[model samples]
Target: MEKMGYQKNWNLDKIFLGGSKSNQFLDYIKRLEVLGRDLERCVKSYTTSLATNEAANLRKLVEYIGEIRVNLSQANSFITCLHSQNTKDQDAATLRGKVAQIESNFEKKLSKVKIILANTKQDVWESLIETKELEDYRFVLNEWRENTDKHFSDEEKNLISDLMADGYHAWGHFYNALVSSINVNVQVDGKEKNLSVGQAINLRSHPNEEVRKESHNALESIGEEKEELFAKILNHIAGFRLQVYKKSGVKSVLEAPLKDNRMKEETLNAMWSVISKYKKPFSNYLNRKAEMMGDSSMKAYNFWAPVTNSNQKIEYDEAAILITEHFSQFGTELEGFVKQAFHEAWIEAEDRANKSAVPFCAAFPLTGESRVFMTFGGTFLNVLTLVHELGHAFHNYAMKSVNGVNKRYPMSVAETASTFSEMIIFDAAMQKAKSKEDKLIILDEKLKCSVMNFMNIHSRFLFEQRFYEERKEGIVSSARLTQLMRDAIHEAYDESLEQPSTYSWVWTPHYYITQSPFYNFPYTFGYFFALGIFAKAKEKGNEFEKDYLNLLRDSGSMTVEDLVMKHLGEDITSEEFWEKGMEICVKDAEEFLKLTSLDDIE
Candidate 1:
């Protein structure tokens, strides 16, 4: 990548003091926090004095609330960014406490406001957006309105929100504890090595079949022993959410997630319907993967096995160049962002002490700066990950202009820009392939990924849906949950797997991820959606690039369907929309097979 002059003069401490003494900064923050409380208190206090449609008072309240909110959030952004980038930094940690204090105090003040809104005239509150300048707050306002209907009382809502710090959220931490503590004893280099779920599952992608099998079996055995506890947790969390959903007048537990996604339930169902019809194509890809791995009886554990020989290494500098070259095709703006990311020292590139295991991107809008956290070890996957995360930085860069409201897109669209960036890098790589062998490896890896994203992920989602449904009636027994899982795997994999049962226990984590219920489908949706969008680009040729970037830019402002319709001239709800995307993947799978020829050898 070309140097964009970010490294010449940059210091993190200039923005944040980085020590406990940053408490001095808290005076300004605390003042703002108190101002926020005053604003909330004022709004709630005057709730009885004015009618919902009282344009003047309502406008004043909304504007004041918006101002307090922006100040509180800006302070929040600074503190959160520092803590996330360097958790051990004392200033950041101190600021985190300050931010928590602000939220706690603000919540107490806001509780009355919430109650007032809940008990108010519904139509009048809904119409407040038009009367006020807070049009960007429609989603949050709607959510607040929904909360009012389900609210027990101001005291009750406060208690529930407080207890949730230790109740629902605590359950999530407990689940994480269980996952972290699980020690699967797998045979590595003829020695028994104890591994965590993250480590063990990764072995399924190992080049060695023996390592993969042992890792898979050991991983399953560990989860099998704890299945009952896992089932209970799943049961408890599902029951909790269903109760909340019912009280809120929401028809389905999925209602909240759908709302959170900012799309209709019908759209999600439509996307999956298209996905289900294309399962055969996914199965065919899996079968090809099995043949490539020389497995007569493939199971879920074998799903991530390397189907092509591409242990290719890349230098960090070269990786940056590839990223810039690929992204530059989109336009100069993205190229500039990519260059800035690499040169500005926005990325923590090499694995080092005090760094976390996973990769993430954090943006600081106060300075139009973004920090990428990843340890680049020069592997192809690492390079791809760099591109993936840089994609996130690029996203926040585009979104910086939309402050406060309308800036936060739903989780569904959050992946759009990143996935779109991945497609760009992959397509560029494919185009520049110097040999058929290289091309085959790239093609096979890409399709193998597509199959896993679409099929394997869908199976996990299928199981979660069943588990939640069953849990609604009562607690699902470990044995019952296991059986349900096997059924889901059977349905999703169908005839693709020679033995799907062996890997049934692999999805235990999904059953227990309390913080993110039904986390499986979003990944599959993101992957295929990007494929659909990329396919459109192919059809439009040169005219597609501007529209693609424009769609990404507007992801924060619009619904998923609106973005799709605006760019692709198609609605995601239609079967044809998904079929087109799946067909493209099928064609890629065919190319992967023809080039690999491992099926012929088999």
Candidate 2:
């Protein structure tokens, strides 16, 4: 495969002329204000009647609202890219705040339209859904109708949406700021240095046992010192959600997330049931890993420890080449898209101080572009990160021609392309490994992802489930939160660890996000979902590539179950479908153990 030149930083100029202060950005904001006013007028003028002209006007209004949303997303994505590159950029922070307010205003206005649609006569609404102009948006229109019962009155809905900006969302901001500012003192090489919570956690993967132990202790200390505050944050967030749920007459807490994910409760239940049955294999992998590390039992900190000491670091250029070469096997389009991403400077992989610690791919629908952010440290893990994010970029590319509204996929299905990409690269790497030790290293990396998705994320789901259940009774204290976390971890891991971290909930930022409740399980969902897709790809080879692209393109237009059924001809709501994915993990675990044994003998 021919190598493509990679850009060190993303080209944000393609979105707007300036970062946050540019006249172009200012002009975009002004346009948003005008659009917001027009949308408000459109909604205010809407009536319950279903006249042909009114239906036509309604379609136009919906399209206009979608346009505004796309522009807003573009603005938000730009500012976020700026903020992520330089966390200390106060200008970016101010712009983000302004954008949030603009979005809130848009939401309040959009609620009126929602009320109009929700209250429309069933026959009229069905007629509108069947209209030629609105045929592409039938799913979104149907979703609006279904959500009619869950909504408050127009006035009440607007009030809740407005209040959520400064009320519910503020708590999440507070938690983010507090956690981001937290610095732990760790002694590295007989000198004490201050490290961010994320940096400290990275040490857990260090080759030295002492470093991992020290980093773990440092994290535990911070959790101990701030548990009460963290607990308050979680409690208040959950309490607010519960209060809203009760006021809105929502039957169950899970209903909101399941609806948001466009997934059914039975599907979630089926997936978890299959996952629960397969825990032993992951536990066995962990035990074997611990034994390889010369430990009596695996500590929580040892989960990410590397099995080999190769210290081989592939440069960014080499990593891109490797990813492109492997992706080429799937199809020309995928390979070309990845090459374009690298050549066009769509990725920001430079490591620098004050950059966001997390890796993410931000898609700008209005511009039909995506930007990837990550600190590449020239490790195998970094290569995986590159490909993983490229998976997201590929998905976005696949749907670039679709309307923005139809491109909005649920988080549950969002990971399908990315995890499938990882599977491709990992399989290729395993095949190309020259020795048992090398293959063991690749297997270990693969299993690490599996353990994270299956075990770590599963524990988070269990904890949140119990937390919400108990939050209905009253406030949960910090100590009690710790106990809940430990209990959940024990249950998920089957009590395999000698000591489970009680403060696990304290460090995770997922619990703090107001918009995304139960954000953890989607990772597990996406992983296994992708696994099943990967299995199909393996069986059908090149024939599956077209279906995979189609699946990615349609992700935003239909429910996950429907998408799977249309593409793979499988029922996602059954344990049988998820069990196929679990069987892959079991096979990987078995292969990992065998390879580790062979490496030991060699």
Candidate 3:
């Protein structure tokens, strides 16, 4: 059965019968609405009578909220699976809106309770969290109390949530649907073929230079054609954020994202400082890659082209075995979990039209299951994505049985297991290389990943920061956004790109994620954070697995600084911690340069 190529389509019937139109799923949705009202009532009761009914009320509030969280995670994950599988799924789209409203309602109610905790007398509030009933939740409770807003009334919060579901989130949903529905024509293997956005992306990694360039051209054409619509979406979504921040007297845009990520400004700066100083090495790698490709420098299309252009096809079945085999070297528990995920048909890697271009792993804690979404192109790069997303699935699996509050980790540290898994697979690939050329190919992939995390991500972060600054004054036009993106890439990539990108801002999903504010930097933060741990793994040798597992389990329960200190014995706020990760990447780029110069391949 494992030889049947690991079942490309996922078994969502295990989640809800009859897919999106299921009456059973509809019933579940109705029940969630009822639970949502119950949660709000519980929030009011728990907030108003902290003295008389502190013990019973506190337990009720936690129980109702926890139950709601389980239901919400299940409903949202299922519909999102449907949406991504077919962005044209109108039934799923409608259900998505309903689920968003329910989630928004629940969040605002939870927000009100946090406000109450901040206003309560200190001794009484401490006593409530100190109770045996809430001992496990004390950390999250304290976090809420400490971070509660000083502005925004209950009605104001509710109004914002209602508008957010229809306005802010709706715009993001529209963008994904529009992009996925778009079909473009590209010449692949001497034949002109119509491809969806996802398929076009697959061809961009083609071993043929012409294929990669043509595919990127077609994909960018979608961004260009949709530029005006995308610009409005960007402005409106960002406009919503700015208005909310202003309404709450928040002066800085980064403030909310930093707080949401449970990270300090110093930790972020520390990561970027390493990237800023070390950009030249990755830029050098890019230039060397271009030279090898018979070009002086790479254009936007060649930014992610396979360096060696290996036509090696690592089919899905082989990928499963390789991922688990390499994963087992680190730990049996993780390897076993990944194998189970494959056998259980938990991943949707179907190469189909109308599917999402990007990859993600969605955690459904209520069912103790996680679904990974991607188009498996059967390249080594696809295999890396396979391992990376599965790592996210396992992270959720590790913490699945924990209470909902404790399992809700911030995005900052969430990439630990995913990128950590990537290193295991990547290192294994490099070690198993059969020749100089093979080693160079694998090393090139590593450098590409590093470039994405640092230079490409920095360009996005810069664009967003400046875009928000511009959006504050007025609606930023499509031309201006393109110019901003171009300027950012030029600076961040050290002006190495032969033709800097202008359309990245339109397709980059990070800019549109309302759920995670400032979504791009956390990726780099997580990448190098995991890289640091991977290096530690080499030092710890046989003992690293246990420590790594402990780190993943505790990710949601600790602050970014405290978590790293406790697990890795390092301060993420210091340049030294990030410098270690940067060194690993820089060495790869240096090696790539040497290899290119030493061996001239036709």
Alpha-carbon TM-score of each model against the true structure: 0.82, 0.95, 0.96
* Candidate ranking (lDDT, best to worst): 3, 2, 1
Q: List the global CA lDDT of all models.
A: 0.66, 0.83, 0.85
Better candidate number, 2 or 3, judged by TM-score = 3
Better candidate number, 1 or 3, judged by TM-score: 3
Query: What ranges in model 3 sit over 4 Å off?
Result: 1-4, 47-49, 52-56, 130-132
In candidate 3, clashing pairs total 0
Question: C-alpha displacement of 388 in model 3, angstroms?
Answer: 1.3
Candidate 1 per-residue lDDT over residues 244-326, each given as its tens digit: 66666677667667766767777778878877777776667677667666666566666666555555556777777778888
Candidate 1 ranges beyond 4 A from true positions = 1-36, 48-128, 131-151, 177-200, 225-233, 315-317, 348-358, 363-365, 374-378, 498-516, 536-550, 597-602
lDDT of 3 by residue, 1-602 (tens): 24646788898998889898988899999999999987766665553426724766676677668778888999999998998988878999889888888898888988888787788888887777778887777878889889877788778888888898888888888888877878899998789988887788777578887888878777677788889999998899999999989988889889999988999999988888889999899888888888888888877677667766466788888888888888888887887898889899999998878888889998888889999999998887798888889989989888876777788898987877888889998888898989888888889889888989998989999999999999999999999999999999888899998765588787788898888878989889889988888889889876887787778888877898999899888988899988888888989988888888877776
Q: Tell how far residue 590 is off in model 3, in angstroms.
A: 1.7
Best by lDDT: 3
Candidate number with greatest TM-score: 3
Candidate 3: C-alpha RMSD to true structure equals 1.8
lDDT of 2 by residue, 1-602 (tens): 56556778999887888786778898888888888888878777767545544657767877887788788888888887987787777788787777788899998876666667777777777777788888888898788767764447767777777778877887887786677677778887678878766567656666667777888888888899989888888988999899889987886889999998999999999988988888899899899888887777789877777787665767899998888889898888888898889888999988655666567898898777899988786778778888899999889888888775677899898888899999999989988999888888888899889888888898999999999999999999888898989988988887777567778798888888898899988888899889888888889987787888888988988998998888888998999998888887898899988777745531
